[model samples]
Target: MKKIILPLMVVLFTACKEKNEKREVSFPEEKTVETPKDTLTKALEEEPALLSLDDVADTTFVRLRDYNRDFVYDMKYATDDNFLKTKVYDCAECYVRAKTAKALIAANEELMGQGYRIKFFDCYRPHDVQKKMWKIVPNPQYVADPAKGSIHNKGGAVDITLVDTDGNELEMGTGFDFFGKEAHHDYTGHPDEVLKNRKLLKETMEKHGFWSIRTEWWHYNLTSASNGKVANFRWDCE
Candidate 1:
């Protein structure tokens, strides 16, 4: 009886040892890899949160770049290349009313889906700048009177054109600020390609609550900005 009991105890001990070995082989401990502190901090700095325009008042003036970086800016008035032939703005910056900026962004998004984007020639002219423009091209057909104030002075107008993904400007019969009959939207004397490009820009802008004048293919005014008070405050060049 004593020998039999001793053999059973040995068998039990061996079985327990085998079970422990299998458990150790089946599940190994996991190793954790730590990221360097500096690398993690750099990544966070590169992707700061963008400000939202939703809480801003519709009439509030806001820089377009702050809300979205998708649009291109030429800001012709900020340079002598414009029809004015002199720099009117202190700097080349695009500032529009919050409402107008929101609509422009929406329009740009739609155009981007089709491989095109909006390029601004001018945006949100201050009342004084409007006067300066009128002095150069006083014709109401080209420049709005500063005394009465234009939609641009109200921060709701934008002169813009479309550019393909390659940054090539779309042909629209005539270049921006061209004071001629050819610049008219009704002018069908242009090639089919020019007309199609103009149609694409006009239709998209109209869909986003903007309207164009008969003489300038690049000019568009936000419908809601018609009643906005003309603003004389200029943006800081900094």
Candidate 2:
């Protein structure tokens, strides 16, 4: 009877141990991490929102880049690559009257849809810069008389060309600021591709309220900005 009882006790102990080892256990789930709302607010406050063109007055001068980032810039006067052969501007900035900016942005959007973009060589020349250009090339045909003030001085004009997605400027018969009959809108000496490229630029700009000059294939003036006062404020380079 003692031996049987001892065997039974050992069997019971082994069974209890097996059951304890096989018992199911659970642990608390980890919480998901999220950024704090105050941290997000601080981040937003660091970067100011871009202003809309509609919120600005039409005649007010504004940097084109501030309103739209789509247009490409190769401001010639800012460097010595222009007809002046001198860096007339402290920095390369494209500023136009708000009305001009609105039209240019619209025109660029149309060009972009056709897989091309507008590349600016000049925009909104200050009165002093115009005088400097006149001193270099006093030809009224090329450089407008500073006393008379050209559309550019009025923040109404832009010198531009079309560039493909690869940034290769389309063959517009002549380079920007080229003063020759070949650059004329009526000049038919160019190849068909060049004519087509010019037509695309001219028509698109006209459709968006800009008119092209008879001589400079690259120059366009916003119709509404024709009466704006000539501006002379220099942009801060820093």
Candidate 3:
């Protein structure tokens, strides 16, 4: 009887010990995550959309009849055979430029009854092409370096002038990107007509969601939002 009772007790103790040792597995505690709070995490400020001349439904291509109040004397970087007619123009190459095929068409329609047109001196300047321009004059005083980049590369900037109905360029004190006192807006030595013309250009572009850069009278940007990231892309024109 004693031997049987002791064996039973030993078996009971072993079962109890094994049961005590068995612990329920636990998972790690959850960690708290934080979100950034500020403008850095927010979307960029957007300007009001300018009217586009080419409706989404339109498949046909139209020529740019003029830039600005049509000055019979306006000029362009390239003629029809050499230039592109894309919606964005040479944006992959240069900073956002003005007078995009779309933008030019819109501006023309707006100024139609006024007897004005658009002309482009420089558009869709490529980064490599900008390098060439800088190489010609390593001075940042005139051209922004290829290393630094220009607003024109963004496809939302433009250097423009006005032309009259007769195709005469409205006289500005100096040509585009001219680095001299002649280009200064306050240079009263220039003719009043030139100053008025510059102001007109600024007002027109500003009304259409563009801002004139202080240094270059004709230089304008489509706000910071439109400037976007300058695409480091190689285009066929480049």
Candidate 4:
């Protein structure tokens, strides 16, 4: 039987080693996400002119769903009920982020040469859509309550990470949605290569105007994410 899946909620950056691979550092796992009910509305009321994913004029969300590959551990993209409108994303900001990221990581040709690509776990989530994330995980300490809003609603914060040209997921310390201390970035004593790779990912993204949240290695917010914001907008995954 053929099967398809979306990346489960990818988690923070950290380090680890396989049977033969060396170790490195990873992101820490602190718990608890309290989202506000009217957070998006408040943000929108405050910055009515702010640009959101909805504002992007031209964008295309490449459908990973169509690809038949072994690399994706689709957790975020999966659904108990085959979800509709869950494939397309507001692609403008993403494109900008990716383009800028490309320039920032230009010096590190190794990553580029290997065709390391970024796959987003969550992006431009609406307060309502966040409900889906929380339901999927249901861990209040890690996943926020959908009744409350998420940063993703802002169309700024995106959870992502590196995959090879072949779409193979690289080993980061922990699996996505792991609510544990091993995910912590400061957690050391692993191999050096993993740590270095994590750093490479972080530094490169930041160089291009992306800011990493302290808790999530794969998560980043664009500097312009908040430019002319809109809120309480309907959230659709596709």
Each prediction's Cα lDDT score? 0.90, 0.89, 0.56, 0.51
* Candidate 1 colliding pairs: none
**TM-score between candidate 4 and the true structure:** 0.51
Higher-ranked by lDDT: 2 or 3: 2
User: What is the Å distance of residue 110 in model 1 from its true position?
Assistant: 0.6
Q: Listing every candidate in turn, what is its Cα RMSD in Å to the true structure after a full C-alpha superposition?
A: 7.8, 6.0, 20.8, 28.9
lDDT of 4 by residue, 1-238 (tens): 1222222222111222242256456789888888876864574456434233333332222222222111133335443321332433333222223222233234234455656766555555555556655666676566667555555555555667677866776667766544456666676754786677678778877766677766666667766654524334542343
Candidate 3 CA-lDDT value: 0.56
| True-vs-predicted CA distance for residue 8, candidate 2, Å | 30
lDDT of 3 by residue, 1-238 (tens): 9999999999999999999889677899999897755552242223223444435322222222222222122233343222221122333222223235455456556655567655566544556656655665678777777675876655556667777776677798887656677777567787788888887777766766677666677666666435454434444443
TM-score leaderboard ranking: 2, 1, 3, 4
Models ranked on lDDT: 1, 2, 3, 4
Q: How many residue pairs clash in each candidate at the backbone level? A: 0, 0, 36, 37
- Cα lDDT tens digits for candidate 2, 1-238: 9989999999999999999999989889889998667854575566456679988988889999777777788999889998778999989999999999999999999999999999999999999988988998898877789988999999999999999998889998888878889999999999999999999999999999999889989999998888878889788885
In model 3, where do residues sit more than 4 Å from their true spots?
Answer: 1-104, 224-226, 232-238
